[model samples]
Target: MTTRQDGERRRGRRPGGTDTKAALLAAAREVFIEQGYDGATVRAIARRAGVDAAMVNHWFGGKEALFAQAVLQLPFNPQELIANLLEGDPDSVGERIVRTFLTTWDAQDGGVFAALIRSVASHDQVANALRDFFIKNVFSQLASVVSVDGRAELRANLVASQMIGLGMVRYVAEFEPLARTDIDTLVKAIGPTLQRYLNGPID
Candidate 1:
């Protein structure tokens, strides 16, 4: 192909060229933050990235997946945690789960996770991604390991609440008591609630 054709293809206009996945992700992040998930359309993101809408779909399944990659900025691929949760013992699942999550966030390069929490409160798409990540990636994986009669969904939600609350005080609101606190201290304070959510009776 000619240089121009090659360049066009690389920009996601034709077949057999470099993927514009990273560019679309960066654009999606900006658009989502500025316009929010509900307001940010595929066309808008594409326009920001200077690529075609088809490229968004080609690179990411849809806005939902794109939102997952762009907004959350999780330190590790969630699937790995999901797999570990599925393989672990059920009784102590909550503590393990909490520790795993904390370890992941604590290791991030700062602000990425905080940014995600801030976006979720204001952006519908980002909120949806957060919810879906918990359901599909976190809770569902844990469900495979432990069966709690009829409270699986509720259990998942409870765990999310705990995590979100921790995130808010530590990252979003930056509450002095929680923000400045060490991870071990925070873990000791919150681990019991998480333990209950995982294994205690759900009334």
Candidate 2:
């Protein structure tokens, strides 16, 4: 049953499923942007992509992984970052965090992170998705090792705040001194603040 519209025949999956992954990624990005991470279901993404729901799992593992690959496009993997950060001394985790994060972003030197921040800032849905993604992926990992007296959620948010601030000034806004400073300088200046946010007693 082929329907002809605009003098073109609609088609189904190709023999080899050449575009399956690409289709999923494209559909996931749109669905995520419109419906947000929570609102966008794997079924919905698959439906929109013209593939079976199970195909999402087969190709991308699941929704969260799909979202990370499709929308976030982060240069480094969150799990890998956690593993590397944990390899160092527990007390120096804060410094490791700053250095690793800055190094990753700096080496990439691409506008992907900046664009992501801009997207979150401009759209409510995207902002919500980003927050959820961060809490689930980034902050949760940090909170695992960073022991706060209480208000762990607040502590996570505070750590996020410091990282976001650094990103904004150094990468997005290109603020002087901070932007021009080397990675070590940044690690020195910002490391202790993040350390405190991660483990210090809240007053």
Candidate 3:
């Protein structure tokens, strides 16, 4: 009975105890930011978290997942995107979606997102992970709500390109005009294009 109880306890929480996953993620975020993606490593993150390297894999699947969770910290979970997309009127989905995304980016601490963009540029795995997160979590969820023809994959990629460019100029590069502009102003300018991608005819 004691042995069984011990097993249950181990399964109940990480070996490092409660909040281990959170600690690891936080450590990973800091390391990724300081080192950039290529410079950051699972062993380094684990060391910062004060846990074995194996713990990272145990908790997050691998370095890529850790990077996604740490750097992205997306506004909503992938599932939530689907739920929101389903809630609003289908016709205005594009506007709502664009506004939603802009709102999220606006709310974050600039440094966190800045690190993510830097990492994406330098590391292929990080770039792929970023792509997967958008497709599986954000775009796929949105696609489930508004049935568009042609593989949902294509539509998702189109939307991603628009958002990625917006991120680059507005957040990463801090380009003039876009960087200084208000969220509402930017949203108005870009929302229509995003809407078209989501719902408008593709020719």
lDDT tens readout by residue for model 3, 107-170: 8766766887777777787777777767667776777544467656776677778877888787
Local accuracy by lDDT, each model: 0.71, 0.75, 0.73
Model 2, range 60-94, lDDT digits (tens) per residue? 88987787687676556776787779676777777
Q: Give the winner by lDDT: 1 or 3.
A: 3
| TM-score against native, each model | 0.73, 0.68, 0.80
Better of 1 and 2 by lDDT: 2
TM-score of 3: 0.80
Best by TM-score: 3
For residue 113, give model 3's deviation from the true position in Å.
Answer: 2.3
TM-score of 2: 0.68
- Please tell me which model should have the higher TM-score, number 1 or number 2: 1
| Per-residue error (Å), model 2, residue 105 | 0.6
